[model samples]
Target: MTVRIGIDGRVLTDRYHGIGRVTHELVRAMAGTPGVELVVFTGEQSASRRFDLNLMAMLPGVEVVPVALNAVDVRQLWRWRPLLRGAMVDVMVFPYHLGAAPLLGRPAVALVHDCILETDPRFAPSPQVGFAYRIMTALVARTATIATVSRASAREVERFYGRRVHPDHVIGNGVDRLRDDPAAARRLESEYGLEPGYVLHVGAQRPHKNVAVLVEAIAEVPDARLVLVGSADERFPDEVAPAIERYGVADRVTRLPFVPEELLGTLYARAALLAYPSLVEGFGLPVLEAMVSRTPVIASDVPVLREVGGSAALYVAPRCARAWAAAITRLLADDDLRDGLVAAGAAHASHFTWGAAAARLVSACHSLAGTYLAEAAR
Candidate 1:
């Protein structure tokens, strides 16, 4: 018999960030599997967004539906409730860790990507919204089977919620090892006028990204330049300019406006080294992406990075400028260290695959549907 599966669609496509990528990967993999029927529910249509066509070609059983999830509007939630439950969705998977309609009382599985808000307080809103959402996460966790990306995260979830999570489902994130495209790498290097011997940093300039620490560290390395690729946002809105001026190595730091995904692989493949000194992260997908692209990475020794990068990355304290600088210089100067990191990264990255994650999720939905049968048998 075909198992009926419903997914929280907007949660997967709306952002297309870490959460969205995982959600899409899961859905795509499940669609290719046998004996499953998928109905994806979403608030909006992301039809135009670029997707890995390999995903579509692989999974033909999944269908996408557009419906307003009414994230904040209660009336919309109340109104959509009956219709969703009436549709007979055996199981609902919320990949974004957001809420569900009251109608989705069917055995639901919620992917708890991480507790970044708790790990880094600044990511939280003022005491009001922060505390409220944190409480909400706990409530939602209580209602669904908790799915965490790492053992570390699962432990944290259990600790925070003051209860053991359902150990039956703990699926780890997988890296899609990006093969090196030398021509593409060379083109990106030349297009950006980036020097061949530059250290690479990927991610947004968020407060907790701890970019300032790396900035100060880069100052110590006067010879090798630094190329930063990410959303050049205004988080440092006012402080960016003055900080660069004060640092004196502003002349050496080359910043890119924005490098789309196509060009990003090349950038990662050719970098002297990749540095990601964020204070906290949900899963730290970039660390794994860099590894897949054959780049040597030096990252903050945080839980997510450790879980994702393994021994493939050079770990440093987020705020330890001296340590970060020393680490970068070591990677640049020592060819052996760089090669070892690359080898380790490739091996570590090989341990992850989108298919593995999606398959387990498919089974979760099947289990959820079985729960209904057990209840009726009673």
Candidate 2:
């Protein structure tokens, strides 16, 4: 029997951020899988954005369906329910968990990236957003089988929301191998005012990201400026500006709002080190991306980071600026240690490929649709 999988393709928009990248890559891989027919449901907004309709059009088992409802269009889902029923979708996979309400009785797979709002409420931009996250969490717990990007995040979801009957699976994220692009690096250097030898940090300056520690640690390292390549949080800059001014490293630190993927890989390739002092992460994607880019990583010694980085990355205490600085300085001076880490990181990174992740996703869909247990006798 063929299982028809309906994927919520709202995340396939032009602004392909972390979640969007996960959805796009996983769907592409799953579309190539032998047994299942893949149907992607997209909205009008996505049609106008940088959606991957071209690739879907080329794939053999994939069908792209335009829906009148957006991902968060809970009110519209009921009105559009007939379309889903008519298509005979065996299971629905919501890559972002925003469309959980409409498919309540169906075997729905909810891809929850993180429980930041549930576990770390301070990270939510506003109270209204926090409330909505809580509601979404409840909806997942009540109606769907959950799939998270990391084991750490799965545990968090189990602890906070799905404490009883909701099933959870860990389908980790994957990174593409970086190509050496000297021209891209030179362009970034010229356009973004980035010098060659600087410590690189890639994340939004949220509270839990702990970027200020890097700001302070950079002051202690000699001739190494910190380049932050993410959207700046206004609150974090207030804290970072003070530290940079006090350390007199104002001119050394460079902050770029958004770095395109090709240039990002180049930036990572050119950096002296990738410093990720995040207090928490669902999955430390940048760590793997940096590792694949052949850059040595120094990240916080948190559970999630430890799970993602393994022995490949040098772990530092999250809040200890002195310890972070010491690690950076020591690694920079020791070429042997850096070489070992770079080689080990590449090998560690190869363990996480989209093909492997897509297999896990297929298994999750099989489990949710009851196809595995039912067809075991065959």
Candidate 3:
């Protein structure tokens, strides 16, 4: 009998951000894996449009099931529970936590990217919202085969749940080099006045992301310009505007709402270094992405960053502006050290590929299926 699998495709909506990209890439790889019939649940009709036919053709043995309901309808979750039940899938994979709805198919595998919601209230619109995520996280931890992107995050998950619910799988996120275009880099340089080399920081201005501290540190580096990319959240404004004004480096900083995919490589390549002083991250993808772009990275000494960047990038204390500035200066001044890091980072990034991550996801799902089957037999 062929084992059936279900995936939540809601993340595929809104142009494939972090979680969405992970879901798409994993599903793309899993389509080739044998003995699995993939069913993707996009809880609303609108989301179906995002999964164009061309993309669907690549995935064999895959079904796209769109619920013909408004997005706000609570029924979207567990509405397809009956359908999944009727199909009797071995495992349903929620690529990210909160993707799990009530009463999902048994032997579910949930990918809890991070416990950021529990760990950082800066992510919450209010205390109630934070509490809700805490409860939701606990539910998934208790009910499913918890899979996470990093061992650090897996430990965080266990910590948040306050118990060893399951031996969470620490499947790392994959890194691939984006397409590079020198012409685009030139244009971006001209457009943004980024002719001089700059330190690139990619990610939202979330408090835990620690962009404010990075900005303060950049002020101390007289020659260094900081390029901040990522959509701004109204709830969590970039709290570093005062620092920017105070440092007299307002002209030195550039903020873009978004970076096109083609120019992302250019941003990485043209940068003197990628400085990621984030206080928390499940997987510091930008570190690996920068490594692939052949840029040296200087990131926080946080466990997750350390785990992901390994020996490929430099690590420093997350909160110390002086420490961050000193690290950036060291990388900027020493060409030999920068060159070595760039080469080592690429070698390190090579160890993480989408194929490897997909294989792990498949293994996790299969293992859960086998366990569920054995339990049923008893």
Q: How many backbone clashes does candidate 1 have?
A: 1
Residue-level lDDT tens digits of model 1 in 1-378: 678787776655433456767767677777757888777765654542435433443468876666765443446436645655666677777776655544455677778877767775676545575687787787777677778777777878877786465655777776675655667767776787764667888776666677777778888886877777655444334334455678987888777756755666777777778889888776788888888888889999987788788778889988888999899888888999888998998888987888887777777778878877789789
- By TM-score, who's the top model here? 3
Cα deviation at 109, candidate 2, in Å, is 0.3
- Model 2 lDDT, residue 39, Cα: 86
How displaced is residue 243 in candidate 2, in Å?
Answer: 4.1
Clashing pairs in 1: 174-352
Q: Residues 133-211, candidate 3, lDDT per residue (tens digit)?
A: 7877787677777788888887887787864434437777898887778788777977766774889999876778888
User: How many clashes would you count in candidate 2?
Assistant: 1
Compose the digit string of candidate 2's lDDT tens values, residues 239-279.
66677788888888998877766677889888889999988
Give the poorly placed runs of model 3, Cα more than 4 Å off.
43-54, 68-73, 86-88, 163-168, 190-193, 374-378
| Model 1 quality (TM-score) | 0.89
Best by lDDT: 2
Ranking by TM-score: 3, 2, 1
Model 1: residues >4 Å from true position, as ranges?
12-16, 45-58, 70-76, 179-183, 186-191, 232-242
